[model samples]
Target: MFTTTAGKPLRYNHWRKSYFDSAVSAAGLADVTPHDLRAPHGTWVADRYGVMTAAHRLGTRTRA
Candidate 1:
């Protein structure tokens, strides 16, 4: 569901490594990967619902 201005699906690895890394680095989070962006979200969802539901929200399959 995510895309670039050219209407192509944003390449996950490239977007994460290039764009997201640079932005977070500029914001002083040099140690964070793009995937870390989901930590707070997953935590909130997990607290409100459960780990299984949080995983589902992140499109993951978990046995919790």
Candidate 2:
């Protein structure tokens, strides 16, 4: 069990590195990090869904 900043027991940070590394290896990619996923996910959702949705999910304002 892991504890958050608020002291709630949760499954956290256990497999984060392993999972990220596996994805990078499987995709034959380089220097990929969790932050890297944010850009593509935001871009895809903005493209397929809408700019507002993507910006909301990414917690950012859309720009022209």
Q: Name the top lDDT candidate.
A: 1
Q: What is every candidate's alpha-carbon RMSD to the true fold?
A: 3.1, 5.3
* Model 1 lDDT per residue over 1-64, tens place: 8898889988888788768888887888668865677989999999999988889999987664
lDDT of each: 0.85, 0.79
lDDT of 1: 0.85
Estimate TM-scores for all models: 0.57, 0.64
Top TM-score model: 2
| 46 Cα displacement, candidate 2 (Å) | 0.8
* Candidate 1: Cα lDDT at 15: 87
For model 1 the TM-score comes to: 0.57
